[model samples]
Target: MKIAVLKESGGEPRVAAIPETVKKFVGLGASVVIEAGAGQGAAISDADFEAAGASLASRADALTGADFILGINGPEPASLAGARSGTRLVAALDPFRRRSDIEAYSAAGLEALAMEWMPRITRAQSMDILSSQSNLAGYKAVVDGASLYGRAFPMMMTAAGTVSPARVFVMGVGVAGLQAIATAKRLGAQVSATDVRSATKEQIQSLGAKPIFVENAAGIEGEGQGGYAGETSEEYRRAQAELVSGHLAKQDIVVTTALIPGKPAPRLISDQQIASMRPGSVIVDLAASAGGNVEGTVDGQTVERHGVKIVGASNLAATLASDASALFARNLFNFLSAYWDKEQGGPVLPDEDEIVKAIRVTHGGRIVSERLAA
Candidate 1:
């Protein structure tokens, strides 16, 4: 099989698979083809792919002749212009939101797999793209928060004086929120966090951070569901804002990492609360792409409030594409291995297998995901 790496479109700095990974495919009797200059930003060189046994080819040629094609994001609506039929395809694909694109791939006779659809089962752990990418996004979120804080992370004693560590407040104790707490602690910052899930408080405390109590509110509606955060009621939101706003006056940095799957992230910071912050405090909103947790966060830009900086950072994972792609490629390998039937020399059909049932979006030239097709 000829597997091609098309140059990533849609501002994706990541290549679907690295040359080292291509070498693995080459060893499996697959011819690896890469579009020239595809790995520039990742510091991957054409020479590296050549050394790893991949053939250099043009994007047009790769699309026309390859049996399999890879991409980081889903197919670009605009760039699908020249993609041909009969090619096996893979990506996150945002299959939950792009029914038309899923149908388009089916219409083109391309078998589609969405990494986002990987089941949260134990066997599918290695194939969990969201976890891998979210792990990185969590790590980077703290880095952004620490950068914006004008004070030192760790407490230090110097000849001049003793500098106390900055206090870091992390909202939402999910994958990203936990990582933020850990990262802030690593940097010697005092970290505290809050979440609607009462079970996560011990986890937060285990990370050497305080867990702010949220139980005093009369009714919190639903805090989360399906391993994802849920939208809290407006009354709960107001209470949360009031409780968290008080912390900002003494905090040096605040990182909000709450997000609901398939929904805009919940707003965790209000203008009044933000303005209450001491000058030079920083709030890094990791949920900026989907609305934001902090009021006044402009997507892809930084704004200051009362000398405090609120950062709306989108796609923090893209900033670490090299590591991100490696982990993502490994996830794909695990998924493909789970679904691949060597007896047939191709992916299974009827799509009844668990992994198949979990990932197949457009099969037999039609939209198949009940989650999206509905």
Candidate 2:
């Protein structure tokens, strides 16, 4: 089987297949082709890939006759224009919001697998791109917030006076949120967190951070499939807002990472909440790309309002290109390895496989995901 790794476009600074992964694909008896300059964003040169036994080719050359194509993001429309039927494409395509891209891929007679849909089962953990990327984003969010804050994170003592540690409030308890809490605590900040899932209270406490509970979540099921948080009712939103309002006033740094799959980020902070915060406080909104969790946040920009700095950093993982690309490329490699058929010397798409069923978005010139079809 011929596997092609294309250079990422759309200003994305990460490559799908790194040199280390190219070596693995070649070990599987597959001919690996990488587009020229594909790994530039990750600080990898074409020479590196060539040394790993991958031939460098132009974008058109790489896609023209390849059996499978890999990318970090969705391929450009023009690149997919000449793809042949039965070609398999894999990427961390955000199909929930980019359904049109999936339709376009299907129309182009290409089979597409979205890495975001990888099941959260133990066996599939290595292939979980969301968790891998989110972990970096969470750590970066804390680092970025600390840089923007005028005061120090850890307490200090001097002949002049004693300085208290900054107070940090994390508004989600997922992989990213938990990382944020741990990072903040390690930086000597007083960290506290809240979540829609009641079970996260123990997780927060285990990290030496206090858990702020939303009292109204008692009868609500906030845990969704694949270990994601589900959407809450209007009543629950009101109670959550009431609980968070009091805590906002005292926080020096607030990092919001709440998200519901296939839905806009639930707004946790309003203008009034921002207005109530003390001057010089910082808020990092990780969900800003899919509609912000904080009101008045603009994706990819930081804005100050009512004396508080609100950072809406989109794609925080991309900021750490080398490490993020390595992790993401490993995820793709693991998924490919799991589905590889040794005797056939290629990937096997078994429809009955739970992991395949969860991630296979399109096949045989049609949208195949039951969730997307619905």
Candidate 3:
């Protein structure tokens, strides 16, 4: 079996497969070919892949006779011109907004597996790209916000006056939010967090951050399918907004990490509330790519409003390309290895398997994912 690792386009720095994963695939009796310079963005070289038993070739040459294709992002259909029909294209295929791409994959008779749609079940934890990438993004959000803030994170006292610690507020207590809270606290900042799920109150406290929850508020039970935050009622939103409006005014740094699966990110901060914060305060919106939690955020750019900086931290994990690539590649490897069939000489995805059911987006020349079908 042949596996092709394609270099990412559109300025994405992370690569899907690393030398470690290429070596693992080789051990599984698969011949691995990497497109030339595929890992350059992650500081890896062709020599490194060659040492791991992977051949470097051009994109067209790499796709020739390939049975499986690996990528950090889904390749444009036009780029897969050389690949044969029924080739399994594995990646974090953003199936929702990229519906046309999914259809194109179906038309091309390729089997598309969306790694991002991996289920939240314990068995699939190691294969979860979202959790792995979001963890890094969360850490970066806090560090980036701290850098943009004019004052120091920790309190300082010397012969002169004392400088108080920065106050950090985190919205959404998911993987990213929790990490952001922990990072801010480690930096000696006083941190607080809020989430639609009341269960996260203890999680926030465990991370040494205060929980800002609305008491006795109805419709705050936002535990969605697949462990994502569900939408709340209008009544609950108003109550939470009032509470957040007051808390946000005093925060020096804010990191918003709330995201609903296949939906636009919830707006956690308003322009009016942003104006209340002191000058030079920083806000990092991790959901900036999903239309932002802050009003003035522009994905991939940092903008200032009312003298406060709003960083549109879209794909913050990509900034740490080396580590992110390693973790992502491992996730892909774990997934394939789990389904590897020694007799078949390649991974076998059973139709009824829970994981296969969850991630298989296109198979048999049709868009088959129930998540998208629904």
Candidate 4:
């Protein structure tokens, strides 16, 4: 089997395959071909992949007669012109926003699988790219917020005076938010978190952070399908907003990580709330890529509003390219290895498999995912 690893476009620093993973695939009797400079952004050299038994070639040369194509992001269809029909392309394809690209992939007869859509089942944990990446993003969010904040994270009692610790409020209690809470607490900040799903209150407390929850609010059970937070009623939103407004005024640093799968991120903070916060306070919005939980987020840019600094961190994991690449490469390896057909010398994804159903976006010259069909 020939596996082709393509370079990501659009300034994406993370690569899909690392040297360690390349070596593993070689052990599985697959010939790996990587595009030249494919791993450069992640500090991986062509020599590194070569040492692991992979050949480095130009993009078109690498794609020629390849059975499987791996990437961090979906490659443009035009860039994949040389690949033969039935070449399976796997990546975080972002099918919702990139519908036109999905169509192009279908027209090209490439089977497209979106790794981000992997289900939250117990068996798929190691294969989950979203969870692995978000864990890093959460830690980065707290660290970034602390760097931007004027006050110290921990209390310091010097001879002159005692500097109180900064107060950090996390709006969302998913993997990212939990990590932010833990990171803030480790930095000795007074950390607190809130989530629409009340079950996460215990999770917040377990991480040594306080949970701020609105009681007696209808539609508070926001736990959605697939372990994601679902949409809530307007009544719950109003109540939560009122509670968070009071809390925001006292926070020195805030990190927002609220997101609904296949929907816009829930707005957790408003302009008025920002105005209420003290000057020099910082907020890191992890949901900036999905329209943000804060009002004035600019996707990848930091913007200031009402004397508060807002860091719109779209892809924080990309900033830690080396480790992120390692983890992401492992995710792909774990997924393919699980379904490997030793005799065929390749992975054979059964059409009826639950995982196949969830992540497969385009197959057999058409859109196939039920989520997309819906």
C-alpha lDDT values of all predictions: 0.78, 0.91, 0.93, 0.93
TM-score for all models, in order of appearance:
0.91, 0.97, 0.98, 0.99
Count of clashes in candidate 2: 0
- How many residue pairs clash per model? 1, 0, 0, 0
**Model 4, 40-125: lDDT tens per residue?**
99999999999999999999899999999999999988999899989999999999999999999999999999999999999999
Query: Of 1 and 3, which scores higher on lDDT?
Result: 3
Model 4 misplacement above 4 A: 219-222
Candidate 3 lDDT, 198-299, residue by residue in tens? 778889999989999888686446456787889998888999999999999999999999888889889989999999999999999999999898898899
For model 3, where is the 10-residue window of minimal lDDT? 216-225
Worst 10-residue lDDT window for candidate 1 reads 218-227
Model 2 clash pairs are none
Query: What TM-score, to 2 decimals, does candidate 2 have?
Result: 0.97
lDDT (tens digit, per residue) of candidate 1 on 33-56: 888978876778889889999888
The deviation in Å at residue 354 for candidate 3 is 0.7
Candidate 2: stretches off by over 4 Å = 216-222
